[model samples]
Target: MSDPTTDPAFLRDPYPAYAALRSRCPVQQVPTGSGGHSSYLVTGFEEARDALADPRLSKNTAAFFAGKESGRRIHPAVAHTMLATDPPQHTRLRRLVTGSFTTRAVDELRPFIARTTDALLDRWPAGGPVDLVAELAVPLPVIVICELLGVPEPDRAEVRRWSGELFASGAPAVIDAASHSLADYMTGLIADKRSRPGNALLDRLIAARDGDDRLSEEELVSLGVLLLVAGHETTTNFLGNAVLSLLLHPAELQRLRQHPDEIPSALDELLRYDSPVSSATFRFTTEAVTLGGTHIPAGKPVLVAIGAANRDPARWPAPDTLDLDRSPAGHLSFGHGIHRCVGAPLAKAEADIALRKLLTRFPDLRLAVSTEHLVWRRTRLVRGLTALPVLASRT
Candidate 1:
């Protein structure tokens, strides 16, 4: 197979390529864009599921890339976040912050979410096209996360830039600078919280402990940095993708307009249909393992194609169809197993509120330009529209 990384068409619409690859075999070694290395891509639903939950597949970056210069690429400050660590560390980090997104906590934030959505919706000038991503998708999650993390209003914009620069596809030096910049910001933020704590999640993290096994200063900074970046990026993509998916399917949009209560299930379907995180972060094998009938050796980087697995025909009856009412029970959109996204509840709440309120407020919301003109993000990690200019109001 060709390098999917270099294909503009593949980047824009990768599902077709993912489907074609899955048809051949679920587990195939693909060329890594970096240094002639090969990584296994798991495309089948069953295979992806198994890969995500497998203990033999490790999340420790250093453990997998030991003795290789590849490990040095990551900024050491944020390298030890829960997403990059295995159990014990992962379990400890997750426990401290998991309560912040419990069902009750997310429910409590509904009023704030509604208020923020309304405030954003009120800014769109009638009869002029608005870039939905700039005015809405990006700000909503950023503001929510900032409020939750006690990020002062002045620093939020810088935080956003750092997060985007770290994730966006660009020059290596620029990306590395952004990574360290954001990590340094987090280090200072944690110290400030230490001096004067508040009720935000970051403050709680500072005080989190389990039988005297408290987080270290480094762990605190890494956790804050992780939350700052991961917290809003995925949701921003999800909101943009969800809106675009609806606008592309007018009938479905009409259905949502008619039954606003269906927004919950619709969000799930939207998530499965076009997961914000197209491909999950890499996992490396700890031992020889067989997946989808292919034998894989140790230390090989493995990628679970979350979007492909969600659309696997073997798993879903009509995989391509965007059926809002379809049950999205086992979708890997929020991932699976111990490392599943801790912010799933918060993400769902944000999408549900954003979509329902936007649709209700702007019944005529439609694309300002042709679908072909909409620019999709080129980053391999996240799948979303870069900008969604829309004629949101009726003439």
Candidate 2:
């Protein structure tokens, strides 16, 4: 049987595949296409939520692969961030950076985000076909993140390229190379900040201290890399997916355009309808645990299918429909428990500004090509369009 996670057809529209797997059993072992390892794929809503918070399920990827002989080697800088740590370590790392992403902090960035959105939209060709993904979706978050991290204008392109490679599907070599390159780049950037302190977030992070403790060099570099990549990638894909969803569901799109005030509240439904992050990061069982009535052995890797969980029929009525009015109270797109995405506030803020500006600027904006021609990226970790070509209004 083909792996639904990687199959091209499934990649384009994975909901059906997720639904099929979810119907049978929410938790089942499936080949993850990584070193021939089969991971427990958790698809049920309740099951996925519980599994995310389960203490036995560890996120320490480096520790889990310590003795395993695998062809793919992840860099220490990439493998040792808060994303891969548990308990005290994760708590400490999260605490150090939490203030930077608070609602207040993100709100302070609204004017900048608005200016950036308007500038990008201003360049759109009049009544011509444009790839929204490339023109708006990709750069908005990338520029926002770069500004936050104090990355120089000249190096931003390289950072974007390396981050893109990090998420390439079925290319372990490229992923590893990107990880190392990004880590090294961040290490250099951190050193530069240390010598010449600036007012950017990276400078604050470099100077951050917790009593007698501070982030080590490796942790600093790792966190920088993590923030750079995670800070924008998810939001980039999210902008693309949210735009596509709105375009596809014209009713909802029109409703939002008519009542612009609803855009903020509508974001939750959009996220749940077609999540940008298909699956949460890799997690391993530190000890045997039962989830969804399935017994998973210790040391086994688990994949919480956020995409599947969000669309579970049991959790939401008419799971496949895009209903803006629906209350998306418990979607796991940003995840659950301690490991939930730290930059979610920023992502939401960017999306809010981008959508409001883009839709208002080109009220008649629409897909430029047939839906069949649209391309979805080949990665299972993130669900997004490679290019979202759309027609913009002349005005």
Candidate 3:
């Protein structure tokens, strides 16, 4: 198969490449532009799940190139985050933030979530031609994350803008600069929060720190920023994708409009049919491990293709078809095993509420432009349309 990374057709729509990978190799070693090459892509459902759960497959990218210095070039601070750690440390880091993400915690904020949704929707112009992304997708998560973190009202826009730049399609220079600026911006916020603690997540995290036992000053700041960026940005893509999907399938939109309770089921199909997270966070191998039918050498980076795995025919009866009623139990959109999304329940709640409300309010919603004319997010890890213009007049 061709390299999906650089292929324009695959970039336009990756399902074909994913399907090809699942059928042809299931697990294939591919080259990366990041100096080092030969990381395994687990395309099959069974193999992806197994690999995700395997303790032997380390999360530490540094371990992938123990001897070769060039291969392990990612920053140290980047490696320290929960996304890049293994066991013991990963457990501790995750524990510190997990309590805040529990169902009860998220449930308590439902009213707030709804309020935010309503507030953004209120801004939508009545009738034709509205950019769903800026009007809805952008504000909902920004407000939610700000409320969660106790980010002050004044700083919210800057934070949101920075986060957008950090995630939006861009050149390497643009991305790197955005990342550094974001980290620095979070550091400043952490300092300010420390001075006058508030009822937000940053304050709570700082208060939660017990002696030298809890997350370090750096970790706390990084975690706060990660939650802000990852927690909000990915969901933005999801909401955008959901809106795009529903716009494409008006029958599905009408179905959701009438039977609101089928939303959870519809979301399942939305997630599987066009998942937000294109690939799992990068994983590195400790020892040379054989996956799918291929042997990967020790010290190489691997990315589990969550998008591909979700559509593997071996797992779903008819992988290409969208079945809203299909059981959502084993979908890997939130991923599987240890590193599954910590804020998944919260994300689901937000999306479900937002989507159902959207369809119910605007039953005649349809894309204002052709799918071919729609520009998609480029360079970002998440797959989403740049803007989804919709006409909502029930004529």
Candidate 4:
């Protein structure tokens, strides 16, 4: 039998497979596509929510692989990020950077985001076909994240290249190379910031202090890499996914164009309908525990299927349908618990501005090709279109 998680069909649309698995059991042991190790897959809505916040599940990747023979080589800075650490350390790291991503801070970027959106749209030719993913979706967030991190204009393109390679799942060599390149770049960037401090977020992070506590050199480098890569990657895919969803559902697209005020609230339903992040990062069982009546042994890896849980029938009636008005308050797209995405507010704000501007500027914007021609990226961590070609009347 093929592994549903890695199968090509599953990569295109994992929901049906997830539904099949959820019918049998919410939590089941499955192969990790790694050295004979099996991980517990959590698919049901409630089960996934509980598992995300479960203290018994550990996120310390370094400790988990300390003695285990692993095939891939990961840089120390990449491996020891807050995403891979447990509390006390995680708490400190999160606190040091939390203020930068607050609602107010993201709000301050609204004018800039709008300006960026207009500039990108301005480049589209009159009544021409454009690849939205390349022209708008990719560059908008990349520029925003790069500017926020103090990356000089000349080097932004290289930074994006390294970040893309880092997410090349199953390609260990590429991932390893990208990790080292990005970490080294960030280490140098941090050093430069120290010598010539500016008002960028990276500068604030470098100067951040808490009761005499300060982020270590290693932590700063790791956090910088994490923020730069994660800051834009998820939102880039999100813009592509969200735009595709809207194009496929014309009524929703028209409705949003007719009433732009609803764009902010409608984003949640769009996120839940087709999540950008298919699965949450890996979590390991610290002790044997029963989730959804399945017994998972200690030290086993666990994967929470965010895409599956968001569409679970029990969670929302007509879960497969895209109802813009549906109250999608509890969706796990940004995840739950302490490790939830710190940049959720920023992602939402970017989507709101991007979608509204795109729809309003090009009222006739639409898909340029048939739905069958659209391709999805083949990666376990994220679900996004490789390209989204659309027709728009440039005004």
Residue-wise C-alpha lDDT for candidate 2, range 114-165, written one tens digit per residue: 9999998889899869999999999999999999989998998899999999
Whole-model Cα lDDT of every candidate shown, in order? 0.87, 0.90, 0.77, 0.88
Candidate 3's displacement at residue 167, Å, is 3.6
Predicted candidate 1 versus true structure: per-residue lDDT over 43-101, tens digit per residue: 99999999999999999985766676653355876565679899888898888889898
Query: Per-residue lDDT of 77-105 in model 4, one digit per residue for the tens?
Result: 88778899999889989987788789999
Give me the overall lDDT of model 1.
0.87
Candidate 3 per-residue C-alpha lDDT over 64-97 given as tens digits, one digit per residue, 9 for 90 to 100: 5457655222234434567877888789888878
Every model's TM-score: 0.96, 0.97, 0.93, 0.97
Clash count list over all predictions = 0, 0, 1, 0
Identify the runs in model 4 with alpha carbons over 4 angstroms from their true place: 1-6, 209-213
Ranking according to TM-score, highest score first: 2, 4, 1, 3
List candidate 2 segments past 4 Å from native. Answer: 34-36, 209-212
Residue 236 lDDT in candidate 3: 84
Q: Mark the regions of model 3 whose C-alpha exceeds 4 Å error after superposition.
A: 1-8, 34-36, 62-79, 168-170, 210-212
- Rank list by lDDT: 2, 4, 1, 3
Model 2 earns a TM-score of: 0.97
Clash pairs, candidate 1, are: none
